[model samples]
Target chain A: MLEVKGLMVFYENALAVNDLSLKVQAGQVVGVIGSNSAGKTTLMNTLSGLILDQRIKELRKGGERITIMGKVIHEGQDISDMPAYERVRLGIVLCRERHPVFPDSTVLENLAIAGHLRSKVEVAQTTELCFDLFPNLTRWRRRKAGFLSGGEQQMLAIGMALVVRPRLLLLDEPLLGLSPAMQEKVVEAIRSVREKTGVTIVIAEQFARPILPMLDFGYVIENGMLTLTGSGRDLMENPEVKSAYFGL
Target chain B: MAAQDTSKQVTRRRERLDRGIKVRSEDIYALNSWREALYLLAPRALPVVALVLLQLLAPEYWQRVLISTTVFALLAISWDLAASSGMVCLGQALFFGVGAYLAGIMNHYLGLPPGLTLPLATLGGGVICTVLLLPVLRLRGIYFAMFTLILPLMIERIIEATKVFGGTEGLSGLTPFSHPLWESFLTMTALWVALFGLRRIMASDYGLVLKGINDNDRAVMSAALNIYRYKAQALFLASATGAFAGAFMTHSYRFVGMPVFALDYSILPIASAAVGGLGTLAGPALGAFILVPLSEMLRGLGGLRIVIYAVLLVVFTVGLPEGVFHYLRRKYTQFERWTEVGK
Candidate 1:
């Protein structure tokens, strides 16, 4: 449902996402696996059109110049210059890296805030779906999102993104800083999300072991350039992928 | 191959690089060459020389304006210091009022000269201000700002109600500087000294601790440092500069009163700092020099003066948020050119 062609992102002089390209089909679990500083977050930001917002802010403050050169096509329409909010309206929602939730808001309130565009009935239905999908969040519905554990916060973040009822969901390092047990729970939740809602999801992560088996298709990126592309099982067995990501 | 073909298209990006001399002079080797040494000194020395020259050339009325400008400039520097050190102060008047009152009281009651009154009032005012603000030092962000905003108004009310230190009428006919030149000379000296001194302090290790406290006091605390003590020290330094300005102005006008704590004294410095740039001690001072003089020049506008003045400020803040000094500094130190990407 999403196509990135010759995507090049520059933060000042540093080339973040080199002239790289990728595609994600509808209802598919596409994974972009890379180590630290592999431009994973930059790629996610570029796809969601958040980079455009950052570019304007940085320009106004006379900070580092951000140059984006590429086309982001969603369902055959060019969304390269579209702002982040507009992209969201087009049902391209991004759950950004780090468990970023409104610290002061309760879990329910956080979900409600994310579902602002939807009808009250739609929002209520999705909120129930989110709590059901991530059962850990149900107990903390009234508790502040900030007080939630890292794993619980991650669940809340994903659930918050799901509340938007996105056609194409982009998850940036969703399992970051979570324990092995929590990672398994998140991976299970991702599996159930696709099974139930059939949402097209693009997950950018460094932890390949938990996600690789679940991904229908996987792309290995190193230093902002796409290095390998294959089925999840094929990547799991690959020697290079084994050593770099799986730490064999 | 298709990506390679697309990448071949010419795309230019503006590349900024530091000047060769700027890089060279950053090293100790710069001291060996007179050119590099002169390059470093020229920016610093020229301003000092210009201020002196302007004092001699300007008419008496303008000189008086210059003195008041210097006072505002000093207050601006203090504001910048407090802001950079993580204390967003809204009541520069608190410091100014305390110092003015102290100087006025000392001069009027004790029959002290400008020299004795100025130093005593500056230090004493700083101490008093620091003690008063000590309770709210732990309050972060808007809470602290709100407390400071109320302080001067509270003090004004107290003075009015108690009728202490001449109250509404205020203490007047205090000792002025013996010579007009001495007034300008002292103010100019204080301005440069405070500017350079604060800049030097900010560059030191102590300044790093202060800055660290501002950035993340918890992180600084994790490193086993007492953030409160550091904050207190920063508060003392900032208030001292503000108090000095107040003391100087008191002697210059030969009067001190409730008007010392006026919102003009509080706001002018912040506006100057915002226009000039914050963090850089000299930048706020430069801002004051520009803003104060500009305001005086706009006096012809009469009723429309503030309207035009405020509009220009909004324009500067919105159009050039980086402030004049930072922009000028970047331009002076670096050169930019369009360069082809991925060539």
Candidate 2:
């Protein structure tokens, strides 16, 4: 389970996330849905403690000053000030947007690099699970991740998150730039992930139509403020959600 | 989630904003007020006044030091110009040596005066250097840098082996400036002209194209502009300034030798630019001013001079990576204050 309390992020004078908060229960597929510039990525970065690293770097380079005011509690532990790597050790893994992979490394190597902290047997089991869940990746296990198509890269990114054996996997814009068919395949992969492993997942996406059907609970954020929160079925039927997200 | 408890904890963040004078001076309306007008003129004017005073008042040895400093400053300016156009030139001495040799040849063989030789060498040396480097213009980043780095060394070897233009002995007792004041005046004139002229050019549309090339040559190429031609023009302009420094130094020393192509000429300019700041034309000049004097002051340390000098460079680079000018500029233009947030 994860809880965010009064999470406010500021890049210099610009209010990126303005006093926004949300929570995810264990084994629940939680969706934080927002359009572009809606602070979805900022929220994900804050939750994963990447903003801390960014803040220090910007400070060193005398660039934009980033300020965060919030308490990120993971299973009742205050992880607000935790570093990104330590948060990763705590099983809070974030598959950042844009399908980031080691462009020079093959798919197998990327997965192997991700699971460096795990035992050999555990890595082997997860690698098998990754290949099983995404059969499209099986043939290209030795191919460079850069050469893989965008959809394949997206799947590989998710598989990479899985390789880390994350307790809380945060997917930031997982369906970004993907075709409709690819979206369905990724949505299906998420469903199977939860059904088989029961991993708690938080997906921040702008495309609500494909993702809303899978989320047990969803929060609609606009301009870093939570606009709506309801169950998947409830949100799917809601006229406001339909008009705003589906362009009904 | 309840908001009442969160509202109780109000956090304060430090906010930075430009000073009123800086903002006001950004507009032509600032000309109405003397304070804003003075603010605009001060940073530009102070340097001119300081350099004049330094030349006139400093002791004889320091005055001689000032000439060499000016030479280095001119070279640093040239380096900054080349770097601004996306060319990381590592062989400024190529421009220097070419101009020195050309000026030395004209004065010795053709019976030319300092006046004729300086101008001829400055322009001629630039053309020669540009032609020499033209073949390698297609290379980018470190490739270009590596090519430029080897050129002066290669030329030095060729001249030594071929035994041309007096070879290692070089051309000596060629000419001297009529007066130290005249020499100081001429070098200062060249320095200011190059500094202000390049700054003006960079602020223009042509400079924008050059900067665009630096940012993304592909994007500039897509816009139907010939980036290579623009890069060559920038190279010529940069090399001309470097050549002028070399030509001037030859007459000042009354000698043009293999030492003209030494690594110190190439490396010192870069170090000055790094310490003073890159991109800004004035920053590199300021860097040369600081570094040259600092090197002189550290002369008492004898062998430790280089060690202390290097340590200071590392300290400056690590502690204030933004460079002193940028840091001071920021302090001058902006003010920061802590303000409450989340309420």
Candidate 3:
């Protein structure tokens, strides 16, 4: 389980994630849906500790020494301000949505590249499990990641992240650019993963339409704020949610 | 009928490609344009090649031409380090001369043979270069190139003013290899071996990390790799290899001087890599062969080869900066990317 509290981030003076807090219980899938400029990516980047603020880079001439503080309790350990790799080692992984596989590498190489932080993922078992999960992958096992189709790439990315056997899986827009058939396939894969591993997942999506039924709890982040939070089914029928997304 | 014919044609094409067939497509033309990078080093080597061929035909110039080619190749290989890293270094001759002089000084003044003196001096030169790299490695773009250039220029002036290496003329006639032909062969072997080692390193994972840094610094760091260390390591390896070539040059030429460490020598390797193709294992050698011979032709015209050199460099850097090997590599990488993107 992962617990986030009073999480706030800034790009110099511009606040990106404004006083936001959220949590994912053990073995549960929590989805975050937001419109464009809703700070979904910023929140994810901040959480993963790859903060690149153009404002902070350019505007600040002198160090006012602005400090950021947040408490991230993961498996009952405080990991706020922890280095990114350390977070990776603690069974926390992020699948950067549409971009997961290193296109320069082979399909097998891309899949193997993940779980690098996990002290060990015996080459044989990892290959076996990954191949079994996506049968389409075996044919292009020697092919480069750059040669893969959208659905295949998505599968490769998800397969790569899941191989790490993380306690917390942060998937950012995993379904983006995927076809309808592949979308169902991805959902099926996520379900199977949840069934097998009980890994806590924080999947941020653009809309709540497709993923709402799968999540136990959900939040609708709007204009850099966590505007609404509720049980998944309740939020699905919420007027504001329907109006903003779901095209109701 | 069309479907059967098309499938058969496709199969035939595939078989031809497998049989080392040359496809005369636009891709090969692009590949050839990249191969034209041989102009970079031809300035250093072409004269030697021509001279050697002339000597072979005319009776006794083989030794001199062979000696000249090896020197140019060694110098070019030394400079290849900077060019391949996408960093312009102008102080390579400084390291090359330092290695040459160190080994020369010890051999001539202290009676050390090429065997003991050469490797030691090369290692010493590499150490000195690593120290220099510590400060200059922080710089990027022109500043980096300038600082690297400044080192050799400053050293050359100092050596001249201080009456070091016989004050500009330098120590001479101390054979690193006793015979001219032996020296040529040894030095040539050393250059190839050094290049072989370097090429292996350049094609490895860590080398790819350097390319990643050159491509996208933030992305590389985000992947949790050290950028500073990578830069330093690359420069260190380059310096060491340059020093090795320089040490071998001392024995072959039987001389070590400030002039040997001049801008001409410093920039030769860059030209070679540009012509041969940056990051290619054999690019510098190829470039050196092409360019060195042209230097002699320029000498006949009162050093007008520089104009040729400048023109070729501008044309290569402007029109074909990737060099032959890289251009070909990029084409394949692009073609593969296109295939993927299409799907």
Candidate 4:
């Protein structure tokens, strides 16, 4: 479970996440749906504590100042100031947008690199589970992750996160730049991932049509502020959601 | 209780904003007033005025140091130009040596004066250097850097072995400039011309192509531009400035030797560029002015001179990785103030 309270993020003078807050229950699929520049990535980064790393790096380079003001309570423990790697140890893993993978590394190597903290047996078990969840990846296990198709890379990215055995998996725009068929495949994979492991998943996406039906609860964000929150079925049928997200 | 406590706390962050004059002067129409015009010209004109004043007031020995400082400054500008265009050159000495030799040969063998030899050597040395480096132009990143690093050393060895161009003894007793004032004046003028000229060129459309080549050559190529041709031109332009410095130095010292190809000629420019800032033409030149004089001042420390200099370089690079020029530029153009968060 996660609780974000009055979370505000500023990149210089620009308020990226403006007093936004959300809550996620254990074993639930929560969707933070928003279009581009709606601070989805910023929210995801804040939750995974990756923004702390970015904040320090930007400060060192005299670049854009990143100011985060809020508390990220993970099951009642304040992790707002925690570093990314420490957050990872707390079983919070983030699959960053655009399916970023080591271009030179094979799919197996990429997964192995993500599972460094776990035992060989645990890694091996998760590797098999990932292959089961997304069968498309099993064939490309030996191929370089770079050589894989965008859809395959997306699946591999999720599988790589799974290798870490994350208690909370944050998928940031998994369907970005994927075809309709690929989106369906990724959507199916997410469904099976939750059904099998009952892992609490937080998916931030602009593609509301594919993601909305699967979300246990959904939050609609615009310009860093939450406008609506409801169950999946309720949001799917809502007139405002249909007009804005579904283009009905 | 906890929610009330959190709500009561206030947080502040420093916000940087461009000065109103800077924002106004950015547009052509808004420069209607004399004050705005002066504001724009002051940062540019003040440095030139200061350099002239320093040369006029300094003693004879320091006057000579000023000339050498300009030479290094020219090389730093050239280095920064080449780097901005994606060709990271490690052989500034290659340009310096070739130009020195060309000028020396013109003066010694052909009996030419300093006036004629300087121009000829600069152009000829640039062409020759471009031709020599053309073969390795396609090599990107460290490969190109390694080739550049090896070049001056290779030329040094060849000169030593073949005994061509006076070999180890080097060409001496060359013609000196007409006057120290003329030499210093000419060098300073070239430094300003090259600095401003290169800055103007980089801001132009042609400079955009060169920058595009550096940023993403493939993207530039996709736009139907020949990156190689652009790169060669940028190389020629950069090498010419470096060569001019070398040719002028040859006459300044009244000698040309293997020391022209020394690592100090190559490294000091790079250090100046790094310390001052990269990309900005004036930044590296300013860096040269700061570093060269700093090195001269440190000469009084004897053996510890180099140790202290190296430590300062490390400190500047590590502590202020963005370089001093960028920091100063930001402060001059923008003001920062604390503002309440979530307002």
Candidate 5:
């Protein structure tokens, strides 16, 4: 289980996530749905501790001053100030938005690189599970990740994250540029991932129609503020969600 | 998400905003107040005032150093200009040496005075350099930089082997300026003109295309603008400035030698640009002024001069990677204050 308390992120004077908070129960596929620039990526980055690295880098370059004021409590421990790599060791893995895989590396190598912290047996088991979950990736195991199509790359991005054996898996915009058919496939992959591994997953996405059906609990964010929070079916049936996200 | 026990948190962030005067002076309203006018004029006027003071007051040895500093400043400005247009020149000395040799040939062979030779070499060197590099204008980034790096060295070898224009001994007793004041005034004038002139050009629409070429040549090409032509023009402008420095230095020393193509000529300008800040014309000039004087001051250390210089360069680069000019400019324009978040 993970709990975010009064999380506030600011890039210079612009408030990204303003006093926003959310929680995820173990094995729950929680969704933080928001439109573009609604701080969805910021929330995801903060949750995975990637923002800490970004903050330090921007600070050193005197570019942007990122101020984060919040507590990220993971299973009763305060991981608010923990570095991203340290958080990764604690099984918090983030598959960043836009299908970021090692472009030059083979699909197999990309998965192996992600499993550096895991035991050989555990890695092999997870690798097998990833290939089983996304058969599209198994066909291009030896091919460079860069040469694969966008949908295939997204699948590989997910497979790479899964290889880490993450207890809390954060996928930021997993279905970003994928077509409708590809979106259905990815949605199905997420469904089977939960059924098989039972990992606590947090998916931040703008495409609500494909994702909403599967989320146990969903938070609808607008301009860094939580506008609505309800059960998946409750959200799907809501008029406002239907108008804004579903484009009904 | 009821009352969580997060009461112990103190949220504060440093906020940076432009100074009122900087914002005021950025527009036509700067003439409204003396304060804004002074703020606008001060940075621009400081160099002119300093140059006049140095001309009138500095010792003879320092005057020579000042001349050399200005020349190096000119070279740095040229380097910055080329770099801004996406040509990362590693052989600024190619432009320098070509101008030096041209001036030397004119003075030694044709018997032209310093006045004619300086102008001739400056413009001729720019044209020659542009033509020489026209073949490789298509190469971007490191490939272009590598070509430039190898050129001066290749030229140096060619001159040595061919034994042209005084060969390795070089042309001596060619021409000296009438007075040190004239030399100082000439170099300083050229330095400021290049700095301010290029800065003004870069702020124009013409400079936008040059910058676009650097940012994304493909995008600029899609806009139907000939990026190579703009790049060549930028190269000519940059090379002209460099050539002027080389030509001026030849007149000052009363000699033009193979050392004109030395790696120091190439490397020092880049080092100055890095220390001062790249992209900004004035930054490179400021950097050259700082570095050349610093190098002169460190002359007593002999073997350890370079060691201390390298250490200081490292410290400046590591401590303030944005460069001193940028850091100072930011401080001057912006004011920062710590404020409580969510208040």
Candidate 6:
């Protein structure tokens, strides 16, 4: 299970995310939605251990330092202070949207490298498991990732995250710029993998029109605050959510 | 309606913004493991094997060419290590030039034997470079490169001006080579050893991190790697190799001249690696094989010799940016794409 509690983040002097808290139970699909500058990216970056502050005089229970306050619990471990790669090593893998795959690498090479933190696994074993999850990736395994189209690159990215066998997979805008059909295909892949692997998932997405119906629970972020929280179906029908997100 | 669209846009923006900031990219995997060693070791043995064959077939008259080429090859390997590891350095001659002169001085003034002279010169160069490398930790890229070139040339010119060490005439009567064949043999052995050692280091986990620093330094640090230590270590290692090469040069011919340690000695090895390819282990060796002999064989052709070599180097740099071996690796990738990978 992954948990975030009393999360407060500031960019130098400006508070970006304030008093935010959320939990990702094992095998649950949770979503965090916000527009640009809503502190969602900041949260993800902070959680993933990228943005580090030198003035971090004190750390909250979950926040990386005093300039920040948050709780990020993963697999019964509090890795809020851990570096990003260590988070990856602990199976908290995030696959960013767009061209996440290494362009110079072959698809197989990309998948194998996705499991790079787990350097102990034999190459052949990694290939077999990765190929089993996304057979399409197997077909394109030897080709350089750069030539892969938008959708293929998305698959390769998610496949890379899966190769680590991440217990908690964070998908950030996996469907962006993708065609509607391609978006549905990627979401379907995510759902199938969730069911197949039973990995806890925290999906931070903008195009919730398609993803919300698939998620179990959702949070609505307006100006860095959680405005609404409920089952995905309730948030889908909420008049406030409809006004804020959907033109009904 | 605009507000609704805006909300969707905000959510979308949030999503794209979050990504794995971990620096362990596929290139890291490629560079870190023993596979990189295979890339270097397999190809480098080719030239060494070729040299061994040439040694059997060729006569002693070619000793000068063989020794100069081998020593230059070692220098090339060292230069490649420094250039490829991180940033750029044209100032490698700081140690190379210093070692040559120091070796000359030791061998001349102290009358050190060939056995003692060679060891002293090489070890002295290595130790001095290792020390100077300390003050040079902070420099990067062009700045780092300039730092190397400026100080060394100034020092060389100053020492040359002093004339206390034979001035413009250079130091002579310093006979360091025991036998003609010994010089060639010693050089070849050093080249092979340097090749083996560098290839090993490059293949190690350290090389992978160094590549990470080269490609994207911030990201590597975000991955929590120690960038400064890696740079310092790699630079020190490279200088040590140059020390050996310079020491060998000063002792082998029993002569020390400013012109000998000029940019050509430095450029010769770098150009060899460049023509062969940067980063790849065999690149420098192959470069040395092709250019050193060509330079020696065609020295009679006057300026055309350098012109031809320069043209070839340019063509290789432009046509094969990855170097000769890397080009072959890319071809291997392409071939696989058409064959098994396509299906």
RMSD of each: 1.6, 2.5, 20.0, 2.5, 2.5, 21.5
TM-score of chain A of each: 0.99, 0.99, 0.88, 0.99, 0.99, 0.86
Worst 10 residues of 2 chain B by lDDT: B1-10
Q: How would you encode candidate 2's per-residue C-alpha lDDT over A182-228 as one tens digit per residue?
A: 99999999899888889999999999999999999998888988888
- The interface RMSD for candidate 2 is 3.6
Task: Name the best candidate (by lDDT).
Answer: 2
Residue B69 in model 5: lDDT: 90
Candidate that beats the other on TM-score, 1 or 4, i.e. the better one? 1
Label model 1 with its docking quality class: acceptable
Please, what are the lDDT tens digits per residue for candidate 5 over residues A1-248?
Answer: 99998888899888898788788999999999899999999999999999999998887666788989878999999999999999999999999999999999999999999899988898899999999999988889999999999999999999989999899999999999999999999999989998998899999999999999999999988898888888888889989999998788
> By DockQ, is 1 or 4 better?
1
- Interface DockQ per candidate: 0.43, 0.36, 0.02, 0.40, 0.36, 0.02
Looking at model 4, give its docking quality level. acceptable
1 or 6, greater by lDDT:
1
lDDT of each residue in B1-343, candidate 1, tens digit only: 1123244666777877789999988879779799999988988999999989889899998998998898999999999999988999999999998998899899999999988999999999999999999999999999998998899999999999999999899999999999999999999999999999989999999999888888898999999999989889889988988998899888888888999989988899899988888788888898899899999999998999999999999988888777888888888888888988662
Per-model C-alpha lDDT, please?
0.91, 0.91, 0.69, 0.91, 0.91, 0.71
For model 5, how does the per-residue alpha-carbon lDDT over B1-343 read when each residue is reduced to its tens digit?
2222335556678899899889889889999999999999998998899888987799988888888998999999999999999899999999999999999999999999999999999999999999999999999999999999999999999989999888899999987999878888888888888988899999999998888888898999999999899999999999999999989888888899889999999999999988888789888888998999999999999999999999999987788777778888889899999987642
> Candidate 1: misplaced stretches above 4 Å?
B1-7
Docking class of 6: incorrect
Estimate, for each residue in B230-301, the C-alpha lDDT of model 3 and write its tens digit: 877776677776776677777776787776677777777777777767656576777776777666556666
Model 5, total clashes? 0
Ranking by TM-score: 1, 4, 5, 2, 6, 3
Per prediction, fnat is 0.24, 0.16, 0.00, 0.32, 0.19, 0.00
Per-candidate iRMS values, in order, are 3.8, 3.6, 26.3, 6.5, 4.2, 18.1
On TM-score, the stronger of 1 and 2 is: 1
Off by over 4 Å in 2: A118-128, B1-6
Stretches off by above 4 angstroms in model 6 are A1-248, B1-46, B59-61, B216-226, B329-343
